[model samples]
Target: MANNQTLIPVAEPVIGDKELAYVTECLKTGWISSLGKYVTTFENRFADYCNTQYGVATFNGTVALHLLAAALNLGPGDEIIMPSLTFVATANAIQYTGATPVFVDSEYGSWNIDPAVVEAAITPRTKAIIAVHLYGHPADMDPLREIAQAHNLLLLEDAAEAHGACYKGQRVGGLSDAAIFSFYGNKIMTTGEGGIIITNDQALSERAFFLENQGRYSDNPYWHPEVAFNYRMTNIQAAVGVAQLERIADLITIRQRNAAYYNQRLAEIDGLTLPPNQDWAENVYWMYSVLLDDTLPLNRDELRQKLRAANIDTRPFFYPVHQLPMYDTKQSLPVAEDLSRRGINLPSGATLTIAQVDYVCDELIKILT
Candidate 1:
């Protein structure tokens, strides 16, 4: 243990002088509300970047999902097919719209929702399928879209963890009827706390805007309208988002390089599995996950403890949502259950250095081997 050594973090947001100066300018401009210039500018820029017609900014990623559910008119009689291998926010958003989230297992290759299972889950009441591109790996979109089309279900992409990811030469955020992105502090891109919904449908985009700003559609501020939640992103947050967007290319590059190092070093280790990406995907890994097979000398939790003892931070894969106390609805899933037990997220952030990645991989390999 040395005082000179800096701890490598599992996820860290890189906030620099640009963000600071932008925030200071926002404060001085007295346009810190949801209607500020930066908010409008950020929306336009992000929409253009994604090659979509519209982008509506929200307070955070969850709000974006909730708005998407509402925009699609998903309700009490509706059901959503999605993976249990995602953050609870994915399920919670569907729940907010009074729709049931039918959880499915993860794909063996990409660790995203298995499109095969999503098709099998389709029913008369299934109104949507939320395809989450987990950990910056673009979920196989074409097959999922085909399934949704067959069932006449809406297709939504929860690209919150995949800001710069692409699939089959198309960007993640513009792939579905509606796609949502998060600008949470820990994501590949950050606005401290913000999100956006992108779509090519004019009606859906307008409805999302209305829902995001409290369901008001009038130009007059004093006009009252139907009930809607307050999910608007402030000008201050948009200002920061604009700065982050400007640097997304560089951030993605850093993430790719760090992920490559982790994959190369950890791939050869017995019983250790790296995050999987398909050939068509340009992965911008938000977190580097390594699976520790049970056949290994130590289980997942034990290895985490061993790594932590060496001052290395790691996170086990999310506890499958179906296994959570609230979601114990007797859903039978074998793959998600197994992957959840074996997966571990290594330190992967835009600010991470090669030396830090090497340190993490070396320590992990040392323990696992």
Candidate 2:
């Protein structure tokens, strides 16, 4: 177990001296709670980065999604459409608001919600569509936007995996009516553990902010008129986030470089299909995934085990939410089901080196051959 097969984790969070120093500074300043300069600074800077008019920081990404559902007033008897291939949070957010989540399948190529399926799922009760840009790839927003427009439904972007990504030259966070971003430990960007909701509408922004901070108005922090959850991001966490935001461009560039290397090295394998991107999409490559053809000698789990045996770390694709225990009542999503069976996540942390990438690809190819 101690030979060349030492594990290379699929993702690693980078917390350099800058982040630590900022946290120390925040601690010394006695402004470590949610109400501090760093928290406001982080929100402002992140809003600017997303090119949106406002950003409301939350404790984590799930809270952001919940807040969005609440802010949009999606509740019992309403319906929301989203891809079943995403993290369960996407669907659970709807359930939190007492709304039903209509699961849609992914397009075979990009692993995003298929527009056709979305069109088919829309009904009179459909109030919104959460177009999640799964695994850092931008969903085809143009057509989805058209569909939403035609039906008079809100299009919300779940850009949790797509920081720094763009669709047709527009930033992902501001491309839809409202967008949510996650800064989880393994995400493309990190605020230690935080999220932001971006919007251009002042009223929506105000509602989102209010919901995020226990429904307390900025004018009267101590007085709460409505019941709201405490989802505010702390100043200490925001300090780390501000530092991470400063280096996001560089982080995205490195991830792109690593993904390109993987593509170049693994493109020749007979059993694998690489990620798909639209001509107009500026993908940030949050995670580099591959699909295993059934014609291949080995299946996805077999390939993953072989790689793990060789010290390379990889992850099996997300299990479609429809298949999960809690979502057994949801409708079937064939495309998402198929992708879940075929896909695998390769090592794609921000700190992955060229040599490490080569090692992962080399091991992957060896198993297939």
Taken over the whole model, the C-alpha lDDT of each candidate is 0.87, 0.88
Backbone clash pairs for candidate 1 read none
Model 2 clashing residue pairs (backbone): none
Model 1, runs deviating above 4 Å: 1-4
Which candidate wins on lDDT? Answer: 2
lDDT of 1 by residue, 1-369 (tens): 221156667889988888888889989988788877899899989988888989999999998999889888888988899999899999998898888999988888899999888877888888888989988999999999898888788889999999889998888989889899999999998988999999999999998887777676677765657778789999999999999988999999999998888888887798877788789999899988878777899988898887787777778889899988977878778888888888888888887888788888778777877
Off by over 4 Å in 2: 1-5
Report per-prediction Cα RMSD to one decimal: 1.6, 1.8
Report the Cα lDDT for residue 254, model 2: 90
Candidate 1 positional error at 1, Å: 14
| 296 Cα displacement, candidate 1 (Å) | 1.1
